[model samples]
Target: MSSLILGIESSCDETGVALVRLPDGGAVPQLLSHALHSQIDMHRAYGGVVPELASRDHIRRVLPLTEHVLKESGTTLQDVDVVAFTRGPGLAGALLVGAGVACALGAALDRPVLGVHHLEGHLLSPFLSEDPPEFPFIALLVSGGHTQLMRVDGVGDYAILGETIDDAAGEAFDKSAKLMGLPYPGGPELSRLAEGGDPEAFKLPRPLLHSGDLDFSFAGLKTAVLTQAKKLGDDLEARKADLAASTQAAIVDVLVRKTLTALKDTGMRRVVVAGGVGANKLLRAQLNAACAKRQIRVHYPELHLCTDNGAMIAMAAAMRLQAGREQAEKTYAFDVKPRWPLDSLK
Candidate 1:
């Protein structure tokens, strides 16, 4: 029997709702419709997300977004068999908004609800793309505050190959951009500014690039960016673009080199890059070029799905259910895990 899964995501600054059809006989789920409302404009004044404000906005948007998704998908609440929500490693208040709505809806419809790990949603996001990857590939999962490379053998089977010790790559980008006086959501802005600047203009550190292990460290790199910006002093304004370029280059270099190391060690020809940073133009170009020379295959989620979204959450739940890796429960006593680890799923 087929089932319609409704997914909700409010783990941070965005509220997203999506519906997917889980077919019988182990096929990949089909995304029916999805909607996202970003809180960027509302939070720009604060420079970053405010937990209380995010939660309130989610409360105002989730239901309307859900209605919009259902209307677009040509479905109704009665058709939904499972409800899924992002259950963590995010602001506690933001997570609760998603959890509360999902559980309440599940109870109202008398359907089962599934709580999905946020990282797991990102890990499996590529399956929603036109060309989904097979099992046993290397995965570079880079989301907010999290940078990890994992060996994904199958659903629920993951082995962490490496991870950040202090600041993640996303942190490096955002922090460095902030130092340069970029606007909020600095990563993308930094990358945009880098297009016209010379990447070789400034010397930057690639932390742990030669550690003989896959582990990553970007805290030192961030510090280096700050030091360089200060040294520029009055000239910082004129060289901001150059600094952004150099910073982005350093981060991308470390990521590409490390990912290549992982490929060599595992002998896996297939790689999947997911998460917010996966949408980076330079990262995509470099990875594509490198993988092509190696005669290896690379896959990525569609740009829209690269960020935190309800589609990934719903897709993750559907895949888990298909693999018999998890079971949705009728109990609606939903609780959010603000610090859940992806390794815990194993």
Candidate 2:
């Protein structure tokens, strides 16, 4: 009999539900069905995600998305062997929506429930693809709220090598885009505008390039963009694309160099890039090139997978279930940890 897992993800503004069929003997898991509802448009006006709004929206969308996943997968609730949901490192209200729904469903079906770390979902996302990386690799997680270098020894073993002291890479991109007059969620938009502009047009500082540690800092670079924008005065709008391009180049340069350094320091040839900034074209291209040049391999989830989604949450849950990490209790009570730590798991 095949084990079907239903995964719920509402860590942020996206509500994702997915089903995965895990077979015996370590065969590759199959994606049965997945559904996602993005609250991007709803929060776009605010220039960034609003926590209260995000929580409210998750409550509205989680149930429908779960139903959609079941219908799309052609499976009934009884067929699901386990229910999994993102449990922490996210907005309290948002995490509760997923946890509440998943626990309720697990109780109704009399199945085991598991709470997965949001970043672990990201770390294991590459497994959803054709050729996944093996264990004991380096991971550079650069998202809107975090920037860290980690050593992944196994499914539940993670060691942090270094992290950011201030603003994350994604936050820097968004802030720089704001300075350049781009709309909210400005990271991607800023990259698009940069396509036609010259990366060498402006000289932006690459913060912490030679800090002699794995830690990163983009706060200074963001300020540099502000200085440049202010210097341009009334013509800032006209030179927006150029400014965007320069800012992106500086960011990518720092990320690539730092990641390569991590790889070299650890002697780990395999590196996986995760989180929102993982979708940046320049970063991908430059990192790919750098890895190739050093005969090192780098892996990334597909563009859609790079951002927050349900499939990864489900997949990671399946892995944990197979490993017999922990089983769910017969409790409908669930609470969210808004500031949970990944290292706290081990």
Candidate 3:
């Protein structure tokens, strides 16, 4: 029998809700509908997320978004077989909002509740795409402030290969953009400006390019951008685009090379890139070219699903059920983990 899974995501600055149908006989789940509300505009004035504000906003958005998803999917709340939520590695207050709401709904309906690891949601997000990857692929996970490479043998079977020692790729992008006076959500803004500049115009460091291990380091690169920006001083505005391009190039170069190294070491011919940075056009193009040259398949989540969303959470929950890796419990006395580790899921 098929089951309806309702998911809520309030891990950070976005409130997302989605509905997915878990088919019988272990088939891939189908996403019926999803909704997302970004706090970018509200956070823009502060230059970053305010945890308290994020929590309050989730309280206001989660139920509404869930209603919208159910309406769009032509389903009722009573039909939901399970309620899933992001339980952490996020803002403490923000996470509690999601966990509390999910458990409350589950209790009211007497449905089981599942708490999903945030990174696992990202890792499994590619399955929601039209071209889903098979098992035993190299996974490049690049979310906010976290960069990791893992060997995914199957659902719930993951081994970490490498991770960032200091700043992650997203931080390098956003920090560099800030140094160059870019606005809030600097990563995408920097990428857009890069389109008009010469990537080779500014020479930047590619940290740990030949570290002999799959580990990554971007703190040095971020420092280099700051130094270069200061040197440009009066001409910084005029050459900002060049700096943006150079910064993006440095980050992407490191990511692509490291991913390729992971594939070589694991002997995996397929790769799945997930998380927010996976939406980067330059990263996708370069990975595609390099993977195609090696006759390796590269998979990514649909662009719209790249950021934090309910679809990934619901999808993760459904997959775990199908794989028998986890069971949705009836206990609604929930707690949130604000600093959970991905590899610890095993």
The per-prediction tally of clashing pairs is 0, 0, 0
- In model 1, which regions exceed 4 Å deviation? none
Clashes of 2: 0
**lDDT, each prediction:** 0.93, 0.88, 0.94
Error of 1 at 103 (Å): 0.7
Candidate 2 regions exceeding 4 Å error are none
State TM-scores per candidate. Answer: 0.99, 0.97, 0.99
Worst 10 residues of 1 by lDDT: 337-346
What TM-score does candidate 3 get on C-alpha atoms? Answer: 0.99
Ranking by TM-score: 3, 1, 2
Q: How do the residues 1-346 of candidate 1 rate in per-residue lDDT, one tens digit apiece?
A: 8999999999999899999999998888999999999999999898888899999999999999999999999989999999999999799999999999999999999999999988899999999999999998999998667999999999999999999999888988888889999999889999999998999999898999999999999999999999999999999999998999999999999999999999999999999999999999999999999999999999999999998899999999999999999999999997899998788795
Residue-wise C-alpha lDDT for candidate 3, range 209-251, written one tens digit per residue: 9999999999999999999999999999999888998899999
The best-first sequence of candidates by lDDT reads 3, 1, 2
